[model samples]
Target: MTLLTPPGVYTPQADTALLAEALRDEAVPPGAQVLDVGTGTGALALAAARRGARVTAVDISWLAVLTARLNARLAGLPVRVVRGNLLAPVAGQAYDLILSNPPYVPARAATPPRHGAARAWDAGHDGRLFVRRICREAPRLLRPGGVLLLVHSALSGPEASLRELRSAGLKAAVAARGFIPFGPVLRARRAWLDAQGLIEETETTEELVVIRAERPV
Candidate 1:
C-alpha cells in the first residue's frame, strides 16, 4: 500500500508503528504539554495528541513538519509542528514526555546520502549522533519525574547510549526493541567494501533498539 505522506518525509513505516504502540500504553497525563523531537509522519507525536496531551512536534525538514501538521488534521488531532533541528524550535519548552526517533545510523560522511531528505534516517558514522544527543540532553528538557522515549540501534550496543543518559543524570531503560534491516549507510558502505573486494554480500544485517528514560523528581 502507498504511504500517506508527502515526499522528503518518511511515510508511516514499521518504526512508526513500533513507536505509536509504545506510547499507546504510557501514562502521559491528559492535557500535559509534550514535545516530540523528530515527528516523522507524526507517528509518536500524533499518538501523544490522541491521548489528549498538548504536543509540539519538531523536525529539521520543512516538508516533514508540514506533513506532520497535515497528518494531525487528517487524524482530527490538533498538534503544533515546527521546523527546527532537535529542540531548536522549542526553546524554554519543558515536556512531560520528550520523545524522538532520530537518525542514529552513526555520524559520518556517506556516499552523499542517496536521498537528501532521508538524512533523517541516517544518524552518523557510528549511528550515535542524534541518539546520543537526544539522551544526553533529554534530562534538561524533561520535567521532574517526566518520561523520555528514544528509539535507536541495539547494534551500537545499549551500554554507550544508556551510560550517556545516566551520566547526564537521568534514569533509563530499554523500553522496547525490534529488528530492522541494515540502514542505507550500512548497505552503501558494504557495497563499497565489496567493490574493493573486502567482504561478501552474504553478511547479515542487524536490528534496532528503542529506549526510554525518566528525569528524577
Candidate 2:
C-alpha cells in the first residue's frame, strides 16, 4: 500500500526492485517514446522520464493511475498516466520501448487480500490473465524493431508466455527473476500447493521472471 493514499482503489504491491534491477543500465534520449504497462506506482515510468524518454504509463485501476500521476509530480517527472485495462487505452500508438509488470496469478481458487492493495496484486485464476493479454497486444503497440519488457510470475508458466509472444510473432527472452511471498489473490495457491506437497513451506523464491520480447522491423 502507498504510504499515504486517497480513498480509492490502489495497486501498491509491485516489486519495484524488479524494474530497478532490470533497468539499472538503461538510458534513453530526450525524445524516445516509452510505454509502461501496469505501471502501479509509476516508478519505472518516472525513471524512464528522468532518462529523457517521453513516458506513457497505463494501469487498470483509477487509483493506481492517480497515484502514478501524483508520484510523477512528486518526483518532478513528466509522465502521462492513463486509466484503462492493458493496452486498451493506448492502441494505435506505437512505442520504441514498452515496459510492463503484469498480474500473472491465475484466476482459480485465489483468495482476496485483507490488505487494501490486494486488488492490484492478484491476476486471474491462472495468473496469466494480464500476462497473456499483454504479450499478445504488446507487439501491436511496439514500433517496428521496438522492445517489449514484461515482468511477471514465472509460476504462470514462463514458456507459455514466450509462446504467446512468439505466436504474436515477436522474439523473446528471459530477462530476470526474483521472489515474492504470498499476497492477495494468489494467497490461496500456496496453501493449496502445500496441501498437495508440491512446495515446501520453507521455500524462499517463486521464480518471478521478467521476459523481454521485441518486434522486428
Candidate 3:
C-alpha cells in the first residue's frame, strides 16, 4: 500500500514491513481493539484494520498523524489517528493488540531528535530509549491475553527487550527476524556504529527482529 509521507514525517521502510508481517501472522479476532504506536504512514494500523480489527494509530509528529489519517481515509479504513507521544493519547484504554516500530537506531545524540525526520529513527546512544519505555508501559495497556508486537534492529538489544517485558510480567520472545541491507540512515552511521562495536566495519546487513510479548490471562 502506497502512503503519502509528507516532509518531516517518517516514511515506512523494511522495519515497518517486518512488523506488518508479524501482525498478519498473529490471530487478530474480528472487532479486536488494536493500537499502533508510532504509526508511521499508518501501515501497521491499516494492516490490522484490514483484518477486521478496530484500530487506533498514534504518532508524535503532527505530519505523521495527518498522513496516517489521510491514508486511512483513502483506503476506506476507519482508523483513529492521534498526534501525541508514544501511547500517551490512548491512556486509560486497553487493547487486544499493541504494535510499534519505534525509533531504534543508535545515534550519537544523547536523546532523540525533538524535531526533524531523524526523530523517526534516532534513539539514544544505545537505541533502547523508546524500546525500553514501550516494554515498561505497553503491558499496562494490554488486556489479559493481549499481545504487543514490536520490531527493532538486533543491534538495539532484543534480549534486553525480552528481559524488560518478562520483568513486567509478560511472556516475551522473538517472533520473526530478517536481515536487511543498511539503509540511508544506517549507512551514514556506519563509521560510528562500527566504532561503538555495534557492528563490524565490513558488515552490510542488520538483523531486524519482531518481538511478541503477551500479557498472561
Candidate 4:
C-alpha cells in the first residue's frame, strides 16, 4: 500500500510488518477496541480497522498524525488518529488490543529526539526509553484479557520487557522473531554498539522480536 510519509514522519518498515503479522494472528473479536501507539503511517491501525475493530492510533508527531489520517482516509478505514505522547491522549480508555512499533534504536542521545525525523527511531543509549514506557503504561490501558503487541530489536532487551510486563501482572512472552540486516541507524552506530558490548564487531544483523503481553482475563 502506498503511504504518504512526509519529511519528518517515520516510514513503516520490517518492524511494522512484523507487528502487523502478529496482529493478524490475534483473535480480535468483532467490534474490539484497538489502540496503535506510535502509528506512523497508520499501517497497523488500518489493518485492525480492516479486521472490523474500532481502531484509535496515537503519535507524538503532528506530521505522523497527519500522514496516518491521510492514509486511513485513502484506505477508507475508520481510524481515529490522535497526536500526543504514548497512552496519554487515551487516558482512562481501555482497549482489547494495543499495537506499537515504538522507537527502539540505541542512539548516542541520552533521551529520544524532541524533533526531527530521528525522533521516530532514536531512543536512549539503551534503546528502551519508549519501549520501557510502553511496558509500564500500556498495561493500564488494557481491558481484562487485552493484549499488547510491541516490536523491537533484541538489543533493546526483550527479556527486560517481558520481566517488566510480568511484574505489572501481565503474561508476557516473545510472540514472533525475525532477523534482518542492520538498517542505516544501526549500521552507523555499529561501532558504538560494539564498544558498548551490545553487539559483536562482526555482527551485521539484528533480531527483532514481537513481545505479546496480555492482561489476565
Q: By descending TM-score, how would the candidates be arranged?
A: 4, 3, 1, 2
Model 3 Cα lDDT, one tens digit per residue, 1-217: 8788888887788888888888889999999999999997898999999999999999998888899999999999999999988988888999999999999999999989898879999999999999999999999999999999999999999999999999999999999999999988889999999999999989999999999999999
| Backbone N/Cα/C clashes per model | 12, 10, 0, 0
CA lDDT, every model vs. true structure: 0.74, 0.75, 0.93, 0.93
The residue-level lDDT of candidate 1 at 174 comes to 82
TM-score of 1: 0.85
Estimate the lDDT of model 3: 0.93
Candidate 1 lDDT over 77-189, as tens digits, reads: 89999888787677776889887888765434642254576577666556666776677677777889888877766645577888888888888888877776665656777
Runs with alpha carbons beyond 4 Å of true place in candidate 1: 1-3, 107-115, 183-185, 191-203
Tens-digit lDDT track for model 4 on 1-217? 7778778888888899899899989998879999999999898899999989999999998888999999999999889999999899999999999999999988887978788889998889999999999999999999999999999999999999999999999999999999999988888888899998899999999999999999999
**Candidate 2 lDDT by residue in tens digits, 1-217:** 2333455544344455675567655455689899999887787888788888999999878777888899888888889999887899999998988998766655444552333555555665556667778888889988888888887776677899898998888998888877777654445567755564535776545667878787878
Instruction: Estimate the TM-score of every prediction.
Output: 0.85, 0.83, 0.97, 0.98
Compute the lDDT of residue 174 as modeled in candidate 2: 86
In terms of TM-score, which candidate is stronger, 1 or 3? 3
- Best prediction by TM-score: 4
Residue 155 of model 3 has an lDDT of 95
Candidate 3 to truth, TM: 0.97
